[model samples]
Target: MDRLHSDPGLLVCPDFTNECYCASCVPFISATITKEQAAESLCLVWVATNDDLCIQWCHQLAEETCISAKQAQAAAAAEATHLHQVHQLEEEMAKADKQKKNRFKHTNILMCPCPDTNEEEAFVSDFVLQKIDKGHFIEFYYWTNIGLEEALFSYSTRDDEGLIPSEQDGATVWISAVASKPSKQVVPDRFLSPVDFAQAVPRVVAALKEHDWPNQWVLMLARFWVAIMTHQYWNSNDQIAQQALMIYQEEQQRAWHNAVVLGNGAWDLSIISNTVLGRLFDHVLCES
Candidate 1:
């Protein structure tokens, strides 16, 4: 990255399929080249779009990485072992199934940071989580304006019938997931823009850096195509932004119902925000 950026024409074809694919053309490709690097290469692709050389590296990396049948079976077995407590195997058809609703009291919901940073608040409300009681498990992505990737929060009670907080008027107290961990020092509540987000990233990163995860984690990633920036630009009054917020609240209401059926009292989740969604803050400067 350093060399390529220093001389804008330099390109490197990595052997990694996800990074770039056509290293065979590297000699003619005319950019600096590396056979294999570290995971940091993938990190760059995740954060920033890839340049020409990087695309070639990613294609090669993806084309070569395949699992053997033996390895695949072993992996399947391991997943079953880990999920045995929550899921049951019906060997007849060889399908995995959740234990009967009467058999299990609660199911756990996992969440994590959204890669886009723009839809941090929207990740929860916009994606809206729900337990089986209300409906099926759904996955989604949304836009948020924050950049910090380490902030985490979750509820702890799983047995309460009405514990999960939705957008409804009355709800239980929701807590920060990683408050026990160290993180930022925001003195007060205010709408933050990209500039303010830069100031807050360090603190948020500090709070979530401690844990090694296999736990339930959710990531909602939106790209330049998402509406996150619009909330801050076109809808400066927040009336429009509030529509997204309402979407979140309704999702919350649904989550509350699902959590009741899933028997997860403390394990439910909620969004705790000091700022409302609007075009008045950080998104304006960055929105394309």
Candidate 2:
């Protein structure tokens, strides 16, 4: 572990020293790395986690989002606050009976699709939104009840070292469901809409054209959709709701900044928004 993470063998113990070192462990350390530099073995997985555009945005955010370094510190502080609250809640939930817990992990996002939110039975998405935003770290735009949507804003079962990213939980886990069937029609409940799902496609294709991601787009997109689709099950508003649309737009801007830095100017905002993204959406939807 020391050799892998560049830490002291037996002299000093860093705060993140609890990571596993077994050979059977999957290379999840590279999960935090960008698609451009990760090994090819993680290619399909890299996409399953995040395609090119999102990875580029995350990397660019490390630098471009910083203005005089103080804002960067603030972002870290914000993330830390979010993580701390999530940890506290996770500890609380893990103590509960197995049938009534949730293992909120990873950094997947969704946005609002419902029109109204004040009514009690308006739509489950609004309920999820409300629940998640109520957390100390989450600043969402809806009202909530259950702690389900609060998963991301609170930060419970995420950031485990040497752990593979997926919807499944390995150890003591928590699964949740929300009802979304309106008049027997499976509509966009508390998660992203079908159109919104297609919105991220151009970003992926552009990432493939400009930078080689560590994974295949097909598997990644499939897994991504599956995760979102999970929100359609059951009825629980006390959980995590969808994320804000502004966050994704910010993601696209960061990708543009990364393209400039890497000299991959062939992929640009106008191109992705107009030609690439529109066409990519058509391509993926046609296959679906």
* lDDT (Cα, tens digit) per residue for candidate 1, span 1-288: 332323222545344445354443334332454433333454356435456446655554454444455678899999889788455544522332333343334433222223333434323321122221123332221112332232223222323323323332355544333322233432221233334433333222222222222223111111111233323432445543434443433344346446745778623333323253333224433442
Q: After the best TM-score superposition of candidate 1, give how far the Cα of residue 68 lies from its true spot, in angstroms.
A: 33
Against the reference, the lDDT scores of all candidates come to: 0.35, 0.36
Alpha-carbon RMSD, each predicted model: 30.5, 34.0
lDDT of 1 at 188: 20
* Stretch of 10 with least lDDT, candidate 2: 135-144
TM-score of each: 0.19, 0.17
Q: For candidate 2, report its TM-score.
A: 0.17
